[model samples]
Structures are given as structure tokens and as C-alpha cells.
Target: MSKLLVKLVVNALFTVPLLLYLSNATPFQALMASLSLSILAFFLGDQWILDEFGNAAATLADGLLAALFVGAMGTAYHWGLSWSALAVIAVVTAAVEFGYHLLLRRWDVRWYS
Candidate 1:
């Protein structure tokens, strides 16, 4: 399998357990926070995988898509059919992820070599 696929699988494996734990602790909101954090981490660390494949955009796109799909799954699992709650979760996740990236960029933190 390709490196990007491997990365996504690994990330999902790590995320699911973490989400489970968080869900147990704070319920659905914790799951949303976990997804946000995972996406931020993946985005910050994407350059290393991109350099390996020579396709930064592709790697980033895949990561974001995976994040959204996972986010939706988590939302569904935790919030059920509550569309309004799901919408709030989505917005908070995006905001947190974007804020994380912005802070990293402002600090000039090079997450990936």
C-alpha cells in the first residue's frame, strides 16, 4: 500500500481508541475535540509524507478527507440524528483545527522535516 494510505490507517487506529476514551469521559464533545486535534496534527505533519510522495496537495487532501469522514462517523455515533448538534461539532472542529495551524505557523514551528 502507499505511504499515504498507511498513514491514514495508522492515524485512524490511533484516533479511534482515543475517541473512545474521550467519549467515555466527556461524551460526544470529547470525540469532537479528539477529531479536531487529530486533523490539526495530520495537517502539521503532512509535509514529511508529502515529501516522500512528492505530492503535497494529494497528501493534504487525503488527510482532510479522512478527517471529515472520521468526524462524521464520530458525530453520528455520539450524537445520533441530531443535525443541529452535529453542525455545531463540525464548526468547532474546523475552528479548532484552523486555530491550531495558525498558531503553529505564527510560532514558526516546523513539525515535519
Candidate 2:
């Protein structure tokens, strides 16, 4: 699938649920925040993933970025402080990513190696 399409679909899927569950704000606010963050994540994350992964980086990046964006948005919205939310998101994302890498290493999957 095209990267743009993947981003759109993933963003919607991620954002909708987060907005529904975490944010006390209106749906539009949640949607807007989610969309904006998702876009930023897609752009930055695509490059990071490509540099880290390879040919399959697009797919991996899409999923990772979507998760990170949604998590960040939810954390921020729930906390009602931009800085705190960002910090939580970054910490959580790093932990999750590290855990994923560790899992891959333990499985001896050469993909991340």
C-alpha cells in the first residue's frame, strides 16, 4: 500500500479510539489533534525507520508512528499539559521500542540486526 494511504488509515484507526477513550474534549478536537500528530509522526518516523530498517521500513514506520502519535496525543490530552504529555509519550515510546528490539534479539531474528 502507498505510504500516504497507510498513514491516513492508520491515523484514523488510532486516533478515533484514543479520542473516544481518553480525551474529554470534543470529537473534532481529538480528531484534529490526532491527525496533526499522526502527520508529524509519519514524516519524522518514516525517515527514522528507513535509516534504521530498510526496504520494509515503510510498513514498520507506519505502524510505529501511528502508535506513538496516538499514545502521545492521548497522554497529552489526558494530562492537559503539553510538556508532560510529550514527556510521557517519549518515555513510553522509547520503552516500547526498546522492548520490541529486545524481543527480536531474543528470538534471534536478524531483521533488526
Candidate 3:
């Protein structure tokens, strides 16, 4: 749980700022997007995919997921976000996620096991 919280915070730190800068998301919208991405990434990328596929694959999955998620959100909300902007957000978030995965491995959290 605590580890998940850390993931959420780290993801939010990167994602919220990018959302605000790259899209027309308000503060609340940005926060919600960040939180939603964080949780989804935690469960899907971190827990399931990481355990099975390791860091590199999980990182890639997370990045793609972020791009799809943000792109969808942008469309739904009329945020005027471009594909290039979504790519930037995904890359940055993936970089952060890579380091975070390293940290998790180093710390040996292994909650599921």
C-alpha cells in the first residue's frame, strides 16, 4: 500500500505538470488524470506485467498505456492535445516509471509474492 502511494505520488509529480502544460486540462482535471493513470499503471504495469515481463517490457507497456489514456481523455474533454504532446507525456512518464521500477526492485517490495 505504501509502495503504491509512492508510485502514485511520483507519477502525479510528472504527469500533472505535463497535462497542464501540454493540454487544456485544469488543475483538477490534471490531478484526476494523474491519479487515474497512477492507479491503473500500478495494478497493470507494476504488479501484473512487471512480475511477468520485467522492467523493460513493463515500462514500454506503461508508456503506451499513458499515451492511449491521455489521448482518449484529451478527445473526450476537448483538451486540444496533439499526438506529439501525448508522446512527450508518455516518454517522460515512462522515464520516471523506469527509475521507479528500479527502485522497487532494489527495495524488494514484492507485495504479491
Models ranked on TM-score: 3, 2, 1
Q: Count clashing residue pairs in model 2.
A: 0
Which candidate number would show the highest TM-score if scored against the true structure? 3
TM-score of model 3 vs. true structure: 0.94
For residue 67, give model 1's deviation from the true position in Å. 8.7
> Candidate 1 — which pairs collide?
none
Runs in model 3 with CA error above 4 Å? 109-113
* TM-score of predicted structure 1: 0.38
- Best by the lDDT measure: 3
- Report residue 84 deviation for candidate 3 (angstroms): 0.6
User: Can you write out model 3's per-residue Cα lDDT over 2-51, one digit (the tens) per residue?
Assistant: 88999989999889999999999999999999999999999999989998
- The backbone clash count of each candidate, in order, is 0, 0, 0
TM-score of every candidate:
0.38, 0.46, 0.94
Candidate 1 lDDT by residue in tens digits, 47-92: 4443344334434444455456545665665534244443443444
